[model samples]
Target: DQQVKQNSPSLSVQEGRISILNCDYTNSMFDYFLWYKKYPAEGPTFLISISSIKDKNEDGRFTVFLNKSAKHLSLHIVPSQPGDSAVYFCAAGKYSGAGSYQLTFGKGTKLSVIP
Candidate 1:
């Protein structure tokens, strides 16, 4: 089963604090992992990604860590701002899939950044 799962449906953090989001997956064939941030009524925007061969990746205020052995991943946002409030989706897929890489996405985690 190519199931990506996000345990928390929602999280709230005060501005300037750290926000942590968790995700899990059951598929071993998934070689590429991605995290997307989505605003209301808009498509998800890619945040960070990590390959199965790597343990961690970072982008500015966002960081993603993957623990392949445990099938777990997490996204950390430091100094969270109100603009960071949005739904985050954790997705996984193989690189060689059909034409476009089909992403298996978690239900989604809503991050509420308080001012």
Candidate 2:
């Protein structure tokens, strides 16, 4: 079963507009979460993260918000630029004991920013 899901396979936004990416998880044990952005050939790069303890986290033009009760999260990019166009993955993590952590990832959503 898929623990995390990105309902929208793709999204498009105009340059200088706001882009909102959504994610949902079925696992309640997830205590930490992260977002990753991947280019065509490079590896997925860490974008932003939010812990269960906090509802929101922001970095520069990127912000992530968590709604624990709804088992949902979202990433908002202000003035979405062309460089921000990429595949975004939502990852949820939990402590599996023995100093090990486990993660579950969504398929990813392709974001396109129009010039």
Candidate 3:
């Protein structure tokens, strides 16, 4: 079973509107959650992250919310732009015994911002 899951395969939004992406995780060991945006072929770029200690984290147009009890998280983009169209992946990581971080990633949600 996938530890991290993105229920929606894709999302479409009009420019200047808000885009909300959802994710869920089954691993309670995961304390650190992150959102990444990926282009066609390039690697995913880090977007926002929230530690289990915080309920919300915001940066500019991007906001991330984490609910530890619910095992759920979401990313909100305000005034979505054409340039914001990309595939978003939700990832969770935890510190391992070997001092390494093991991460599990959701499939992805492709966001299309129509102009």
Candidate 4:
């Protein structure tokens, strides 16, 4: 069972507030972790990623923290805006033979930004 789990299906936050989304995994072999943000009807776009070798990664308003010991990870958005409203998906993968990347994604967490 290669299921990545996002416990909360939805989250709401006021504009300029901080938003945090959580995810958990059962597989211990997963080495690469990625976060994607998606708008309605469109494919998810890569937001940020962190490897199992590191504990944290950040980009502008977004930061992702990983706790290997807990088999959990979270994405944090600072000063959330209306444009931040979208579904966030957490994915995990490891390099296999033939150089192909196979990803297992969470159900997704819908973030509603109230402006």
Candidate 5:
């Protein structure tokens, strides 16, 4: 069974608007969640993260919210720009003793920010 799932295959947003991407996980052991953004030909770059201990985390234009009881999480980006158009992946993980994360990722959702 897939542990992490991004139900929406794609999303579109107008410039300067808000874009919200949702994710779900089945594994209770996952204590950390990460969002990654990928361009057409480049590697996925880390965007935001949230620890299960916290309900929310924010950095600049990005914010992540975790609803542990619902086994769900979401990434919100305000004032979305064209540069933000990319594939976003949701990853769930457990922090290991070494402070590393063992993650399971979703298929990813393609985001289009229309100018």
Candidate 6:
């Protein structure tokens, strides 16, 4: 079974409005989480991230919230713009015994920001 899951397949928001995307994970070992945005034919670009030690992290219009007790997380985009429309994916990373972390990504949620 997949460790990370994004329930909503897509979402639409008007420009200058708020866009919210949710994700869930079943792995208790995951100590870090990240949100990425991807455009068609291009690789995903890192957006924001939260560590197990922190409940939230924010950058500009992007914010990532983590709820360890619920094994869930969400991303918020405020004042959304048309350029923000893209496929967003949430990923979980667990520290392996070998000294590195392995990541598992959710299916993704396509967000459309209308003008």
lDDT of each: 0.93, 0.97, 0.96, 0.95, 0.96, 0.95
Q: Write the per-residue lDDT of candidate 1 for residues 43-114, one digit (tens) a residue.
A: 899999998999989889999999998999999999899999999999998756467677889999999999
lDDT string for model 4 (11-96, tens) is 99999999999999998888989999999999999999999999999999999999999999999999899999999999999766
Screening candidate 3 with a backbone cut-off below 3 angstroms (N, C-alpha, C), the clashing residue pairs are: none
Please report, as a residue range, the 10-residue window in candidate 5 with the lowest summed lDDT.
93-102
Model 4 global lDDT (CA atoms, 0 to 1): 0.95
**Can you give the TM-score per candidate against the true fold?**
0.93, 0.98, 0.98, 0.95, 0.94, 0.97
Whole-model lDDT, candidate 1? 0.93
Which regions of candidate 2 are displaced past 4 Å? Answer: none
Residue pairs with colliding backbones in model 6 are none
Error of 1 at 10 (Å): 0.3
- How much is the lDDT of residue 35 in candidate 1? 95
Alpha-carbon shift of residue 98 in model 5 (angstroms): 9.8
Per-residue alpha-carbon lDDT of candidate 5 for residues 3-99, written as tens digits (9 for 90 to 100)? 9999999999999999999999999999899999999989999999999999999999999999999999999999899999999999998866687
TM-score of 4: 0.95
- Cα-lDDT of candidate 2: 0.97
Instruction: Mark the 10 consecutive residues where model 3 has the least summed lDDT.
Output: 95-104
Model 4 residue 84 distance off true place after TM-score fit, in angstroms: 0.3
CA RMSD per model (angstroms): 1.5, 0.7, 0.6, 1.1, 1.7, 0.8
Model 5 has how many clashing residue pairs? 0
Q: Which stretches of candidate 5 lie over 4 Å from their true place?
A: 95-100
Highest-scoring model, lDDT: 2
**For model 2, what is the error of residue 91's alpha carbon versus the real structure, in angstroms, after optimal superposition?**
0.3
